[model samples]
Target: MKKIIAYNMLMVALFTPICCAQDIARIVEDVGKSVVVVIGFNVDSTANKLGSGCFINNKGVILTNAHVIDSCLSLQIELTDTIIEVAANSNGLFCTTRKTIKIYLTKCS
Candidate 1:
């Protein structure tokens, strides 16, 4: 019985990482679908900042760092082949009712 238990424990230890690796791979694939490129434009309409963010939900809500869109007059969100341009408000909020897009900013540093 002692030898059987030891063998089972060793088998579990070796297989556990394999199972976890599959889970990690699935998570990475899922997250890749939600990733987007955030481009910030200066007052002169030139792209000055670049960052990456992810869609938090299916309603076009994006979650990104505050610094990515800071001091910008407009922003361009690129997802796959779609590029969306929206104006930013003074309080760092980007909203466009026409496209039902909203951006939520958080300080990453």
Candidate 2:
């Protein structure tokens, strides 16, 4: 009985990561729609830099790093289903939506 219990514990420990991974995968798949790629555009409409953001209130509020749009004249949000370009207002370290909103690219830092 002791040996059986030990074996069961070992099995659970080994499979725990796999189970967690699957759960994380499912969560990402479900919530990935809320994620967006924040693109900063210069005055000439040229892309400057890219950052990541997510919807805060589902009503067009986005939260992202301030540095992403520090010097940007405009902003564009790339979502899974659509892309939205709008004016942006940046404070010291926060972005507030003044208007209206990619895929699974496997690029890593």
Candidate 3:
């Protein structure tokens, strides 16, 4: 019936956010091992603090903010689990790597 369809649509809409959030959480978790937290500044003297990055390729490619790296020529990736650091660099935007990693955190944001 039309009423039933409408009710179902409403229910789905209400739960869509939860589903999307879960999906994002999964992505975050899956990439947490390859992701890193970055902090730096921008050219305009603004405090561009606190950001995150993830790897998407097997060649140690990393993605993050140009501003967060303070526009530096190179970068450093810190893994959450192994607590290891890797030297890297970015070309103004996003990095790439295919490595899967586990992120350890008391809270996720």
Candidate 4:
């Protein structure tokens, strides 16, 4: 009886971590849609660049400094999740020879 009690107590200790992990998994799974992954490409590295755009309604916009996305023909916006999807591709905008791309989010739209 004494050994059985000790063994049961050990099992309870192991069970505690599993319960906590389940709680964390549930929270992340429920709120994953609110997160995003931002990716960009720029050919010119010497100058500072960025862009700013609206992301409300049916639009998924990318705004950055003037030098950030210069010469980038496209920008990719994806959801941060297991089945990550590239939700949008921005049409390129240029100032001088530098181009910045603006993509519309498909999934979010």
Candidate 5:
């Protein structure tokens, strides 16, 4: 009985990390799909600031620091293959220049 218990414990210790590793990999892949690059530009088309953010929901809402989009006349959100441009309005609402696209999150190296 003692030998069997020791073997089982050893097996679990080795397999636990493997299972955890697989879970971590899947999570990274899933989150990577939502990562975005935020670029703020001035009225003259010069880049003002660059930051990173992720989509918090499916409704095209992004969660980022206020300083990322501060004092910019327009903003650009870069996804895997899409670039979304929006002008800064008085109400802080954004109007996309193109059709709506899905957002994904990612982990940056």
Candidate 6:
């Protein structure tokens, strides 16, 4: 009886990580709709940088790395779900004017 209990515990411990990974993956899938690909453009309408960001609210607010938009004259944010459905690269999205957008840093103090 002791050996059987130990064997069962070992199996449970070994499978715990796999189960946790699945749960994490499911969470990501659900949250992926709120994720976007942030693209920066120069004054000449050329690509400057690319990075990922997450929308914090339904008002189109995005949080991303500072370097992602460095030296950029314009920005474009494409929803991951839309990108997946379009099957196109970052160029598929339209650029948004700077006046109509806002970005915030999420760094820990």
> Per-residue alpha-carbon lDDT of model 1 for 21-105, expressed as tens digits?
9999999988887999999999899999999989888776788878888888888888776788878766667776444455554
lDDT against the true structure, each candidate: 0.81, 0.69, 0.53, 0.45, 0.76, 0.65
Q: Please identify which of the two predictions, 1 or 3, would achieve the higher lDDT against the true structure.
A: 1
Query: What C-alpha lDDT does candidate 5 achieve relative to the native structure?
Result: 0.76
lDDT of 6 by residue, 40-95 (tens): 77768887789998878865556778777666656666765343211122543333
lDDT of 5 by residue, 1-109 (tens): 9999999999999999999999999999899878889998987989988998888887766777778777777888988778887776675555553566643222222
Per-residue lDDT tens digits for candidate 4, residues 1-109, read 9999999999999999999999999998765644444444444422232333333432334334444344554444444432222212344542121133234422221
Estimate the TM-score for candidate 6.
0.59
Lowest summed lDDT across 10 adjacent residues in model 1 is found at 98-107
For each candidate, what TM-score against the reference?
0.65, 0.63, 0.42, 0.36, 0.78, 0.59
* Model 2 Cα lDDT, one tens digit per residue, 1-98: 99999999999999999999999999999889788898877779899979998876756666777767766777777879777666643432223343
> Worst ten-residue run, lDDT, model 4?
94-103
lDDT tens digits, residues 1-109, model 3? 9999999999999999999999999998886667666544444544445577776565555566544565433333455754332223333432434255422211112
Between candidates 1 and 4, the one scoring higher on TM-score is 1
Q: Pick the candidate with the highest TM-score.
A: 5
Count backbone clashes in candidate 5: 10
Q: Count the backbone clashes (under 3 Å) in each candidate.
A: 0, 1, 9, 18, 10, 0
Better of 1 and 2 by TM-score: 1
Question: In candidate 3, how many Å is residue 19 off?
Answer: 1.8
